[model samples]
Every structure is written in C-alpha cells, then in structure tokens.
Target chain A: MTSIAVPPSAPEHTGSRLTRVLGAATAVSWVVWLTYGLVLSPADVVQSESVRLFYLHVPLALSAYLGFTVTLVGSILVLRKNSAFWDQMAGAGAEVGLVLAGLVLVTGALWGRPTWGTYWVWDPRITATTLLFLVYLGYLVVRRLDLDAEVRARRAAVFGIVAFINVPITRYSVQIWNSLHQEATLSLTDTEMDGSQLTSFALGAIAMALFTTWLIIHRFRVGWLEYELDRSGLESAILERRGERTATEVV
Target chain B: MIAAVAGDAARIVAKDLRIERATGVITTQILPFGIVMLLLFGFGVDPALQVRGGDRSVLAEVAPGLFWITVLLALLLVVGRAFAVESDDGSLDALLVAGVHPAAILGGKAVVVAAELVVLELVVGAGAVLMFDVTIGDPLHLVVVMVSTTVALAGAGTLFLAVVAGQRGRDTLGPLLVLPAMAPVLIGATAAAGDALYGAGSGGIAWTWALVAFALLYSVAGIVGAGALLEDV
Candidate 1:
C-alpha cells in the first residue's frame, strides 16, 4: 500500500480510524456515481443517452475546481504559517487537481463532440478552463524545480497564490466573451433538472466530492511520509560519515 | 519611507535605462525583431490582395488584433530580458542584498518595461498603418487602450519574471507561464483596440475599462507580493 518508503516506526494509528471511514465512504461514493450514471437518471431530452456524460463530466469538473480551491487555501496558509503540512497539502491538491483538470477537458471535448457537432470551439468556458489547466500545470512544474524543499515550497506557494488570483479573471473574461456553448442548465438561481434526474445529479456531485477528498487525504499522507523518511535517512547518513572519519583518524 | 523606496527605484530604473541606451539593445535588437514580426503578419494578412480589390475593410478589421498580439510578444521579450539581465553576472543576488525594498525593485523594473512598450507600440503602430492601410476611428480611445494595456503588461510581466527567474529553462517557461495568465488582458486589449479602430461600439468601452482594472490589479499584486516572491530565493 505504501508507494513511498515509510519508516516502520512512523505512527500509523493516529488517523487510522478516520482513514478507514473515509475509505468506506469513497467506495460507497464511487458506487453511487456509477449507479446514477447507469441506471438511476433517465436519459436527457436533447442529448438523449449521451447526457449520461453529464453525470460523469460535471462531477469531475466540480471536483477539479474544488481541488484547486483546496490548493489555494493550503497555499495561503503555507505563506501565512510556513507550515510543512500546508506545503504538503498544497502540493498534493495541485497534483490531483491537475489530473482531474485534464480529465475535465477530455470529458468536455467528448461531451461537446456529440452536443455541438464538433470536438472543439473557442467558447469562453472552454478557453478559460484551458487556461486554468495550463496555469496549475505551471504550478506543478514550479514545484519540481531543483531547490531545497523549504525554498521550493515557498516559491510554489507564491505561484499557487498568484495562479488562484488568475482563476476568477479567466472565468470572468470567458463569461464576458460571447460563447457558442449553451447556457448553463444548473445554477444557484435556477436548475433545469427535475425529479429523479436532480436527485441523481445531487448524489453524483456528493459522491464525487467525497471521492476527491479521499484522494487528497491519501496523497497528502503519502507526501508527508516521504519527506519524513528522507529527513531521517539524511540524518543517519551524516552521522555515519562522521563516525567513519573518526575511525580512520584513530587507525 | 515612500520617498526612500521611490528614490531607490529611480536609481534602478536609471541604471537600467542607461544600460539600454549605451548598448542600444532596444533599438538594435528589439526594433528589428518587431519589424520582422510586422512583416510576417502583413504577409499573413496578405493586404496586397485586399488592396487590389479596392476593399481595405478586412485589413482594418484585423489590424488591432495583429497590433496587440505583436505588442504582447514584444512585452514578453522585454520582460524576459529585464529579469535575464539581473540573473547575468550574479547581480540578482547583489540586488537582493543591496538593502533596497523589493517592491521598489519591482516598481523600477515595471516602469522600465512600460517605457520600452511605449516605443514598441509606436513602431508596431506605424508598421500596421503603412502595411495594412488601417484607419483609426478614435485616436484618443486607442491611446487610452494602449496606455492601460502597457501598464497592465508591465505589472504582470514583472511579477511573472520574478516567479520564473530562478528556474531552469526560464526562457521558455516564463512565456508559457505568463501568456496563459495574460490571456484575459490580451482579449480585453484587442477587443478595445478593435473597437477604437473600426468604431465597434458594443462592449468596447467596457473592455477598455476592464483593461484599466487589470492594470490596477496587477500593479497592486506585484507591489504587495514582491517581497514574498523575493524572500529566500
């Protein structure tokens, strides 16, 4: 289960209970999403069975947005407190967010192909989403720069905050530009969804949200463990080098 | 404190300007690059074909977009060069420890960039008129659009410079990072300029106002966040 090397003595029980519960919840949520996509919701009117893509697509898009938002919050805290935990959280969130964002773009294109008769358009939402994806991908690239962990975290934090600042502007600009894409059917003010479709959508959204949270938690934990192991290994190596020098001098 | 910071910033700007003047880098290097880009754009638009038909409307329509895109490219070059200059000869470390406020450093660099962009626009604007036979519907509106867009690019470019200066392959990565973020500004500026050139009334003024807002937003972000970006780098 450990993708990263972890010390055997590292406390595994501190959050074990929460992890187990979340694991079960994640499993349940995936089931719910699949069931809703396959059986629960009726086919859409204009889109027909292709509207099932909506069940998968919207939740993933929302999850990607939620992940980036979490990264933004973590970055803000990282800057404020300079905490390693916040750094790890931000990195994990961005990594997962990037993957989900790519999926969002792919799913969007797939959905567009059937609905709009083309796989691509310079529609504002698509443009903005593309920009969002690029910006965070740049964020992850910044994190990979060859610097000390502390320095890297600080740099990535600054970028993280800056990138988030662009999100709203990107969204607003795209919305401001005339879009060929259809107007949103689901929103706070009004929703076209009704009866069983609405219920299934709600379930899909909740399940996706839960699944997203579980992924982030697991990613962050793995990252924390990796760093901890690195530090310990570095300390032991330094001590062994000192011992070797003393032994050579005595001989 | 403000005066002291302003004084330091002025010194940095003066130093940078003096270097540009002595080296003639702006006139010799950037000017040639801008002209070449204008030539390529003119060829791409193929204004010669339109002129033979006695209809210059298509040329006029594409003129603003072509102009702003050229400026965006020029802005990217200048921003990359400005930071690259600091990284050369280990001056970035020197500048950091020189006891100057980091915001002042950003302010100094931004003003220099804004100045350079003014010259770039003049050259690009002249080329567009001569090559495309473009007409300006509202010179005043165009000036407003140009100034605000220049300032917006300056502020945001400085911030992005700081973000990528220390990274490897910064030359390529810097543009990659800045261009996507600058997408909105590009859209707004192009729309406003297009509106000013062809007298497209709808949403033109609004887009111009958005450019002004962008200028303010980027300047504030750069000024406020410069210290954090420079810290421990």
Candidate 2:
C-alpha cells in the first residue's frame, strides 16, 4: 500500500487527536481557573460565595469593554484613512467583543438568580447592557449589507465608531439611574478584594487575557483567509464578466 | 427678499409633508400596532399589574415605560423614512451643497417629526386610557409633558438622522445608534410621567427640565454634527 505523504518539519495529528489536544488544554485551564476563582479565592465577607461569580462576570465584562474600545480605535482609523489593516483589526475586535459580551450576558444571568432571585432584571444597567449587545449585533447585521465590499467596509467602519456610544452608557448606567446591578469593584488604584482572592482573580483574569489575545490572533488569520477566498472568487467572476462585456460590445 | 426666503423654507417643509402623507411608512403602521398591543395586553392576555408578585401594572408605573417604548418603536420605524424621499431623487447631495443652512434643514424636519410624534402620542395615549383604564392625575400637565418629551425624543432622533442619512447601512444603524443616545430623555420623560401619576408634582417639574436639557443638547449636538459631516455626505 502506498504510504500517505507527510509534510516534513510540521507536526502531524489525525483529526480526532487535534480535538483531544484542544479539549485537554481547555480542561486543564478550566480546572485551574475555576479552582482559583471558587475555592482558593476568599469570598467577600459581605457577599459570601455569591461573590465567586465576580471571577467570571468582571473579567468577561471588562474584556467585552476592551473589545469595543479596540473596535472604536480600528473603526476610526479605517474611516479616516482607508486601510485594510484597520478594517481587519476592527473585524477581529468586534468578533472578540461579541464573544466576551455574550459571556457577560450568560454569567450575569447565572449570578443574578442567587443575588436578585431572578435570572434577569430590566434595571438600568441590565437594560443598558442589553442595548449595548443589540448595537454589536447591529454591526453584524450591517456587515451583511449587500454592497461593494469596499463600500460595506467603509459603511460598517462609520457605524462601528458611532455605535460605541453604548459603551460609556453600559459602564456608567449604574450611576446614572437606579439599577440592581452593583457598581464596579475594581479600579486601577483600588480593588475591594483581599490579597489572596485578588491573586486568584488576577491569575484567572491573566489567563482570560491570554486566551483572548490568542483567540484574536486565530480570528484575524481566519479573516484574512476568508478575504483571500473572496478576492479570488471576485477576480474570476470579474474576468468572466469582462469577457461577456467584450463579446456584447463586439456584437 | 424676506418673503422669498420664508416662501422657500415653507415650500421645502410642505414638500416633506406632502411626501410623508403620500407614503405611509413603518411609523404610521407601528403606532396603531402599538395601540393594539396595549389593547391586547389589557384584554387579559397577561396580568398587567405590579401587585401579582411582579405585576408591573399596565397603566401606572410601567405605563410610562410602555408609552415611551411604543414611541421609541414608532420613531425607529419613521426616522429612516425621512431621507428616503431625497435619496430617491438623488437630491440629498444637491440639497446639502445648495448653501441652505443645515439648521433650517434639521429644524424643518424636526417640526415634521414633532408633529408626527404629537399625533402618535395622542393615539397611543387614548388607547392606553381606554383599554387599560389608565388614570390621569392632571390631564393638562400630562399633555404638556408628553408633547415636550416627544419633542425632545424626536429632536435627538432627527438630528442624528440628518448627520447619518446619506451614509451606508444608515437605515439600520441609525435606530441602533440613536436609541442609546435617547436613553436619558426616555428615562427622564418616563420618570416625570410616573411622578405625576403618584401626585408628586415637583418631581414632575424636575423631570420636565431634564427633558428640556436633553432637547437643547440634542439641538446643539445635532446641528454641529450635521455641519461637520455634511461635507462627507
């Protein structure tokens, strides 16, 4: 039997092994992070075990905020001066932000039940986050607009920059009105957690930061590949179209 | 010359009005639909009271929110329609470069949207009172508050529209962007309405000024934003 040719100097794995490797990595990190977050971290004397959820909620929410911030910078750059790099970065940031925001929604819902005796409340903060989520969702919807690719990119860039209004509102909503959601506990200079608890959280947050950055790198590569596919398809289509145009002209 | 200027502005306003009357947009549709929704809720489809553990009464405390949500939905549907007429004729670009002050452009459109809001609030309010049996403490103040708040909401919305009208994907993104910006107005208006329902006259007054501030902010922001971005459009 002919042997399957293996590429030299590259690691080889069957399809199943690849997934097993990923799952193993995920399980290891998940255990380490959750252990640090749940058991090792000291519970707030006031909030008790309920505060454990902060391990997920705060990191997820802050990551989401950072995503939008990155998206804003990218959008402004792209719109002010047309550049593919900015557009790609914006796409990357938005995709990551959407994931983090989704996590925030789920984690917040999980935390709400124990604290508020409900899964969701229409408090100003919750409503504002929901609204903010809708805006990111809006960006995805706008991305689907049927137009020239460049036109769509430019239009989406403008929309991204403008729609970031919700970012500030989502952050300040608790202060602006009565809301069930608590104020942020972590400031650059001040944090409410004890040292050990803070250490565990800092570790989990650092892990999340690593995961997010890695995910973005992968996502950007995927975006570049997809763009390449589309570009090749467009070229072939244009060639066919041009040939038709000449035939019609001659006729 | 003054007569001609007034005539020109008036003619432009009339054209918008005539076009609006001709094409019944999503706003006109959503208004009746919102009323019907309130009616449906009142017909005992769901408990509309804040007393049944989580009642959130259909026509009192939550009533103000329901009213504005209905207003917000209707405005969402209509605001995009404002630019449709000019865009269709390809005249929006020409209109921007015609040396007419952008204020006049936004002001004229604001008037139209304000009028629409008044008419819409009347219908939605009447439906709430009739179907859900809402109580009105001061009918006159309620009327004033509703009108003023509607003006505030529409002013912000239309101003945003003027700035973003010609851009790509604006039809969808306009509402998404504006609703967040309108939260302060919506919150203040709803709070004022709630206070009046509870016999707190002074809080109502306090919230009224909030509406005025929002309106003024919308006006200034909208005008300056439009002036800056007009060249791009």
Q: lDDT tens digits, residues A123-167, model 2?
A: 877787777887787676666666556665665676676567668
Q: What TM-score fits each model?
A: 0.93, 0.70
What tens-digit string does per-residue lDDT give for candidate 1 at B1-233?
98998999999899999988998989998888888987887677655555555445566667787777888888888988888778767687788897888888889999999999999899989988887788888999999999999999999888887876666788888887788888888888989998888777758899999999999989988887787777655
Q: What DockQ does model 2 achieve?
A: 0.21
Interface DockQ of each model: 0.61, 0.21
Name model 2 segments beyond 4 Å from true: A1-35, A43-50, A188-191, A228-251, B1-12, B21-58, B80-111, B122-152, B155-185, B196-233
Q: Which candidate gets the maximum TM-score versus the true structure? A: 1
Q: Specify the highest-DockQ model's number.
A: 1
Candidate 2: pairs in clash:
B49-B55, B50-B55, B50-B56, B50-B57
Query: Taking the tens digit of each residue's C-alpha lDDT, what string does model 1 give over A82-116?
Result: 78899989988988888888898898899999899
Per-residue lDDT tens digits of candidate 2, residues B3-121?
54345556667878887778765356756777776765555445635334433353445677787878887786666666666766767667767765555566667667777777788
Q: What's model 2's lDDT at B30?
A: 54
Please give the lDDT score at residue B61 for candidate 1. Answer: 69
lDDT of 2 at A62: 74
